[model samples]
Target: MIKGKGYLKFSKSKNKIYVYLFGRLTGEEKKKNLFAFGRLENALENMYQIRESDRLPAELSELGFNFDDLDEWILALETRTTRNNKKINLPVIEERCFEDVTNYDLLGMSEKEVKSLNKDETFKMYSDLLEMIFGALAHIEELEEIEEG
Candidate 1:
């Protein structure tokens, strides 16, 4: 298990990955039962919308915390989480030579906006975002250096 942020864990084969609040909302500093928002995106989004006292820190990273930009990191996080949760794999041309992939909009994007995007546009967006994540992870060990230094 890859641990982060108190008791949060990410596994190479993690299924039903959740984001939970750990730590204190009250003035006391004892353990509190975790409140899971079911998914990281839901937790992060709601954590921002709700009072800070209602939750603990929900940063994108816990170890080292070397994020440069929150928004970019969030997009990368969402892309990674969504793809992982969906188990997205490289499209095999023969597997879909005669079938059409289902059309679906992003979870929170407005339907009108999604409707304006064609399959190519959606795929391009996914490709670019995922590439950004891969690039970022390539330098992930830098955060460890920051921590040790």
Candidate 2:
């Protein structure tokens, strides 16, 4: 029942879904898993395209998630609740936006060009730019606090 904007690896065992975020299993106790994508469109396309036929077990077909909306699936996971009052462990969407912006190529553009392109009229580009700005700001604040301490 994991959702959000990135790649997720999952499997169903004993009527439960075991989700892995950013290539690491849930048992690892990692706080966050970074995704590399320039825009939310790219991220959503990758996330929603996952079908139950991909990696799910035969028993999971009866679960509601097989036909549920992506957002609903995410919500269910976040609350750790199933439709039938069962508890399920799932991956969390640490951040709705991609984390590793540098990992994506801006179509062979230079740094300056990339910055300029971010000002384009496309809504997707603007959204990505905003997310990147906030993420950078948070990182800077964390670094400053670490240095001060």
Candidate 3:
């Protein structure tokens, strides 16, 4: 099942999460983000090399996501396709947010944007973005259950 189905928002000030769904997304848009999300999930899996613990900081841990949950949620989002008669794995992601599926292209930052941030700044930004992604994953799981039930 497609989880989140769009863009997810996390409000730092209010400590709340929101999801904006793009129920009208085109096929190309969904395919693009699906690949993007798959890439992101693969990166995270490779970096951690383990998804059995809480990877968030003490403060952000309050957001209620653990690496394990995020891992499982992303696994649930996986879909299969065939390219050149070869079975390939992809994600089932939809474009439903303030912006289009381009939001899923986490690595789309320009060289200038990348260089402007020092290591610490970049890590902070990465952590914050991760928090949002985890929140989105949890929401997707819930939405999937809702749809199933």
Candidate 4:
């Protein structure tokens, strides 16, 4: 399995189903992939419009996310505050929270594995990965390391 800092895992156990967020891509990286990030941002913004909680899983499904699989663990939704400072909690299935991941590996796929996927599959894979990475990036503010002046 390709383990890295910038990945999300949505797993289902006999008793529970959940999503965990790992590391996030840097600002430069996000800029280079603006289209993907744009979709994610738009999605988040759109999510606020539908205030119903029960519809989230179905909504995620419509957006190419299948929560039934174990290995596909891929979302860590946070309650986002709007410009007016109103909190919007868009829950997926169960509890959603971010786990600290210190590594910087972007994709866990190998060359052969990536090559084997069809064009549509490849695009979906990238979209999903970017969605997760972008989601994490949008929620948290990255801190800069300050050296002694």
Candidate 5:
């Protein structure tokens, strides 16, 4: 599942915690699963806090979640909160045309030879570059948040 941003708001009037999950809800099953996982997290945390004074409950396995499932849930929570809520102002990513790279011989290859490569190769390279750029931006945002906090 792709990570999406979400917010948990405590509604005093309704006496309920309202969760706002920002993502595509394609089916009823998916929506139910998401809500269940969120509630499970809250319950687990509350139970652990009540049971243990300072230390964490012995490795979540004791708390009833299989280690693998716990890891997956933690990963999903992090992805949703960190990637979705964290905002970054990035420069417009420029899409390079075939002509743009023609001037430079990539890997010392001639312009003609480079141009002969399939469009897939060119697109793959661009995608990898953009991924790296976004990763760096995310890291920077995390660092700023840490410092501010």
Candidate 6:
């Protein structure tokens, strides 16, 4: 299942997380991020050389995401969209937000121009580039809040 359809599902989900985090899309549109997390757990299990844990802060930290952000990002995937009644929001994340996703190819795309794109297009470009940058593993996933806590 991790070959074709599974790959498609992971790609779509990775896009959802990126788009949702960027504040360009409605919370209603973000789907669950659990599938990616599950696959990660499986892959880690296979990596017998390295130990694994349900709390993902260490693994995610290695990816350069801050500890505090991990909880909120997971919520965007696995739990309610809003923290309270208010919308979960973000500043416009550009190449600065991620070291791995941005590249020389995007050096000419102004941050303003990028922020102006519609959510669908923004997500597409972000996910497409991320897939290119980190390949399929970028979509692997993180720990859910409860799982981490």
Question: RMSD of each candidate?
Answer: 13.4, 17.4, 16.7, 19.7, 15.9, 15.7
lDDT of each: 0.40, 0.39, 0.38, 0.36, 0.40, 0.36
What ranges in model 5 sit over 4 Å off? 1-98, 101-114
Which candidate ranks first by TM-score, i.e. highest? 3
lDDT of 5 by residue, 1-149 (tens): 32332222222122223222233233323422233223322533443333335443353333343444444334333333333455322222223344566555443556665566565665555445445654565577579779999
lDDT of 1: 0.40
- Candidate that beats the other on TM-score, 3 or 4, i.e. the better one: 3
lDDT tens per residue, model 2, 1-115: 2233223334434432345334233344443443231232243333334432354333233222343444444333334455456655332222222233464465344444444
Residue 139 of model 3, lDDT score: 75
TM agreement with the true structure for every prediction = 0.26, 0.22, 0.30, 0.25, 0.29, 0.26
* Model 3: CA > 4 A from native: 1-110
Model 1 clashing residue pairs (backbone): none
Q: In model 6, which regions exceed 4 Å deviation?
A: 1-107, 136-149
**Would you list the rank order by TM-score, best first?**
3, 5, 6, 1, 4, 2
lDDT accuracy of residue 57 in candidate 5: 38
The better-scoring model by lDDT among 3 and 6 is 3
For candidate 1, write residues 1-149 as lDDT tens digits.
Answer: 11232333232113223444344433455655344444532544554334324433454233222232233334334454431355323221221211232343332345555556665666555455446555554456457568889
